[model samples]
Target: MKGPLFYSKILLFGEYGIIKDSKGLSIPYSFYNGALKNDGNASEAALNSNQSLKRFASYLKDIDQDLVRFDIDKLTDDVNAGMYFDSSIPQGYGVGSSGALVAAIYDQYAFDKITVLENLTREKLLKLKQIFSAMESFFHGKSSGLDPLNSYLSIPILINSKDNIEATGIPAQQSDGKGAVFLIDSGIIGETAPMVSLFMENMKQEGFRNMLKNQFIKHTDACVDDFLKGDIKSLFKNTKQLSKIVLNHFKPMIPQQFHELWKKGIDTNAYYLKLCGSGGGGYILGFTEDFEKAKKALSAHKLEVVYNF
Candidate 1:
C-alpha cells in the first residue's frame, strides 16, 4: 500500500518572526518529498518510521474529536502491517521533513479531511492550519502548521499575520536571470525543540521583544510583500536588512562556523544569508543578485539554488 507523495517546504521570508505574528511566505520545495508505503519488510529505517507512526497514531486518537477526527484503528493496523513513511526529506534540515509526514497522515487517515481540490476559502485555510498545528505539535512542542499546509496544498502560502493567511502566487522564476535564492548546507543536524525553546527564552527579554517587533517582523513583512508584488529591488533591499537583523540577534541559532560567512555576504554584497528554519545547524538560506558571484564567493560550500530571478 502506498499513498501519494507530499513535497517539502521552505519558509523563505519568515523563520523566527512568524512566531510573533509576523508576516511569512512559504513555498513548496519539490526537490525533497516523501510518501507512505507498506513494504511488508521490517528494514531498520522502515521499522523506525513504523514505530514513530505508532506513537503518532496514539497521539491522534487522543486529540479532541471536535478538532479533528482520524481513522485511528486503520492507522494502527497499517503500522502493525509494516506501513511506514518512505521519504527522502532530510530531518533537522528545516525543510519540513516531519511536516510532510504529518500532511501525509492527515491526508490518508483524517475523516472528512479538507481535500486540496476544494475551493479553499480563508475559513477553510484557517481550519486546516489549526488542525495541522494541533497534529504537528506532537513533533514540535508548538507549531504554526505552515510547513504542513504548504506541503499539503503544494502552493505558496502567505501569512499576513497569525490569523490571516492565503494561497499566494510568487514571481515567476527566471531561468536566464542572474539573481537567485539558494540553500547552503551546514552539515550539522539541528533539533527544532531546543532552537524553539531558545527563541522563547530570548522572547522574555524586553530588548529582544522590541527588536523582534520593530525590526525583525517589519523587514520580514516587507520582504513578503515585495516578493509577491515582483519588486525585485525592494525584495533584495529588505532581505539584506532582514539578514543583518538575524545576524545580530539570532546568533545562537546560527552555527558558529558560518558566523563569518554570514557577515561576509553582508560586507561583500555578494549574497545575504538568513536562517532557513529553526537554525542551529541545518541549511542557511542565501540570496544574491548575482548567482555566479555568490557561487564564486562561497566555492568551498555546497549550495543549492531554489529560485532564480
Candidate 2:
C-alpha cells in the first residue's frame, strides 16, 4: 500500500542558531519528496530502506507512551511484507530527507494523529512538535523536531522562539526578479550529529557564546524578520554579516574547499553563503541580489535556485 507523500523541508533561516532559541523559518520544498510503498523489487536502496524502517518502528515502540502511540503490529507486518520508503530526497543534504520519512511513517501508522485539516492552535502545534521531536530523535541523538513538523504540515513554519512557533506565510516569489536564493551543491555529504557536536563543544567557550549572541543570532533573527516583511534590501545586509560570523567562528562545520568561496561572496557581494544545515558539506545556501552575477561567480559549481526576490 502507498501512503500519502511527505515533502522535504528547507530551514530558510535559523540553522544552528535555533538551538539557542533564535527565531527560525522553515518551508516545505516540494521539489523532492517521499512516500511509503510496497517494495516490488529487491533493489539495494529499497532493501536498505525496508531494513531501516524496521529499526525505526522498533524505536517508536520504545518512545514514551504519553507522547504518541503507533500501530506497531501493523507497521511491523507492513515491513515484513516488504514495505519500504521510496524517495528522491537526497540524504545528508540538509534538506530534511529523514524528516520526510518520519512524516510519512507518522501519517500512516500513528494512532490518534493530528490532522492538518484541523484548526492548528499554538498548543496543538507545540504538541505536534514535541511528538515529532521525540520521534525524530531516534535518527539524530537530539532533535528540535522542526524538520519533520515542516514536512508533515507541508507549510511554512515560523519559530518565534523555543516555546513559541506558528504557521507563517513568506513573501511571494517574484517571477522575474533578479535577486534570488539558491542552493550550491557541496558535492560532499554532511552528517548533522558531528556538526552539532562541534557546535556544542565550541559553546563551552565564553568567546563562542558571546559571538553567538552578539553576532550570529542577532543577524539571524534580523534576517528572518526582514525576509518575512518583504524587505529584500535589509535581508541581504543582515545575511552578509551572518555569513561573516559563520566563516569566522564556525569554521569546523564548513568544508575546507568552500572557505574561499564563502568569503568571496561576502567580499564581492555576488552572493552570501551560509550553512544550509550543519555546513560540513552537503548544500551551501546562497543569497544574491543578481542571480546572473552569482551564477557567473560560482560557475565551476552546481547551483539550484530555490527562491527569487
Candidate 3:
C-alpha cells in the first residue's frame, strides 16, 4: 500500500536561532523523499525502521492520555502489520529522515489532527507543533516539530519571529541560470545529541552568546531576508559571511578532520559551506553561483544540487 509522500526538508535559514525565536525559513527539497510502504520482504533498513516505529508507537500510546491529537488505534494496527518506512532520504545526514517518518505517521494515522488544508492559523500551527514535538522527541531528544510540520505541509514556511509562522513562497527557480544552491555530503555521520549538547554548553559562556547575538544571528537573519525578498546577490553575500562565522565560532560542530577543507572553500571563494542541520558532521550545505567552479573545488567530496538559480 502506498501512503502519502513526505519530502525531505532543508532549513535554508535558522538552525539554532529558531530555538531562541529568531527568524527562520525552510523549503521542501524534493530530491529526497519517503513514504509508507507495506513490503513483504523487509530490507535491513526497513526492519530497523519498523523496530524504531514500534518503540515510537508505544511512546505515543503512553503519552496519549496527556495528549490529544494522536490516533493510537490506527498506529497500533499499522505496527502490527509490518509497516516500515521505505525512503531514499539518508539518515544521520540532517535531511529530516526521522522527520519524514514522523510526518508520514501523522498524515496516515492521526485521527483528529489538524488538516494542512484548513486555515492553519498560528494557534492551530502551534498546537500541531506541540503534538509533533512530543511525537518526534522519540527520535530526537528534543524537537521544535518544525521538520515534520514542513514535510507534512509541503510548502515554504516562514517563521515571522518566534511564536509565529505561516506558509510562504519563494521565487521561481530559473532553469537556465548559472547560480545554484545545494548540499555537500561531508562523508561523516553527524550525531544530533552530542552536537546539540555542545551548543548548549557553548550557550553557557558569555562570549558564545555575544557571538550568536551579534554575528551568527545577524548574518542568519539577513540571509533569510535576502532569500525571501529574492535578492539573490545579497543572499549569497550574506550566506558567505554566515558560513565564515560558523567556521570560526562553531568549530566544535564541524568535523575536526574537515577543518582544512572547510577553510579552503572560504579562502578560495569557490564555495561557501554552512551547517545543514545540527552539524556534528552530517551534510554540510554549500552555496556557489558557479556550479562548475564549486564542483571543481569540491571534487573530492560528493555534492547534490537542489536548485539552479
Candidate 4:
C-alpha cells in the first residue's frame, strides 16, 4: 500500500535554543522525502527499517498507558504486510531521515491518532508532541518530537517558546534576489545520539553555557529575527558570526577536515556556513549573496541550491 510521503526538515533557527524556551522555526525540506510502500526487495536497508519499526512498536506498547496510546495490532499488521520505507533522505546526517520515517508510521498506523484533516489546535499539537516524543524515543534515546511533528504536519512550525508551537509562514522565497541559501553536503554521516550526549555534557560547564547564552544563541536569535523580517543583509551578517561562533565553540560538532573551508567563508566574505542539523557531519547550510563568488571559493565541494533570488 502506498502511503503519504513525509519530507526531511531543516531547523532554520533555535537548534539548542528551543530547549531553553527560545523562539524557534522549522520548515519542511521537500528535496529529500520518503514514503511507506509494500515491496519485495527486503534488502539490508529494508530489513533494518523493519526491525526498527518493530522495536518502535514495542516501545510504544511499553510506554505508560495513560501518557501515550496507539493501536499496536494495526501497526503490526502493516509491518507484516511488507511495509518498507522507501526514502532518499540520508540516515544519521541530522536531516530528519528517521524523523520522516517516524512521521509516516504514525500517520498510517495510529488508530486514534490525530488526522491531518482535523483541526490541529495547540492542544492537539501539544498532545501529538507528547505522543511523538514517546514514540520517537525508540530512535533517539531521547527526543523533543519536534522533527517528526514538523515532517508529519509538513508545514512551517514556529516555536514561540518551549510549551508553544504552531504552523507559521515564512516570507516567500525571493525570485529575483541576488543572494542564495543552499546546502553543502558534508559527504559523511552523523549520529544524533552521541552528538546530543556531547552537547549535554558541555552544558554542565559554566563556560559553555556562557558562550551559548551570550554569543551563540544571541547571534542565532538575531539571524532568525532578521530572516523573518526579510532583512537579508543583517541575516547574512549574523549568520557569518553564528558560523564563526560554531566553528570556534562547537568545534567538536564540526568535522575536523572542513575547518579551513569553514573559516574561508568568514575570512573571504563570500559565504557563511552553519549547521543544518546537529552538525556532526550532515548537510551544512550556507548563505551567499553572490553565488558565483561562493561557488568559486568552494569549488572543490558540491553545493545544492535550496533557494536563489
Best by lDDT: 1
Model 2 Cα lDDT, one tens digit per residue, 126-216: 9999999998998889999999999999999999999999999998999899999899988999999999998999999999999998999
With candidate 3 superimposed using the best TM-score fit, by how many Å does residue 171's alpha carbon deviate from the native? 0.9
Steric overlap count per candidate = 0, 0, 0, 1
Per-residue lDDT of model 1, residues 223-256, tens digit only: 9989989899999899999989999999999999
lDDT of 4 by residue, 1-309 (tens): 788889999888777666666677888999999998876666898887777777777777778777656688987887777678889999877778878988988888776778778988998888888877877888889888888998999988888776888888888987787788888888889888888889899999999899888888788888878877888889888888998888988888888888999998999989988887788898888889999899999898898887775
Candidate 3 accuracy as TM-score: 0.95
Q: Which digits, one per residue and each the tens of the lDDT, describe model 3 over residues 46-141? A: 888788888888887766555555777888787778888889988888888888988999888777778888998888887777777887888889
Q: Sorted on lDDT, highest at the top, how do the candidates line up? A: 1, 2, 3, 4
lDDT of 2: 0.92
TM-scores, in order shown?
0.99, 0.99, 0.95, 0.95
Error of 2 at 26 (Å): 0.4
TM for candidate 2 is 0.99
**Per-candidate local distance difference test:** 0.94, 0.92, 0.85, 0.84
Model 1 per-residue lDDT at 122: 97
- Give me the runs in candidate 1 sitting further than 4 Å from their true place: none
lDDT of 1: 0.94
> Cα lDDT for residue 91, model 4?
89
TM-score of 1: 0.99
Error of 3 at 87 (Å): 1.3
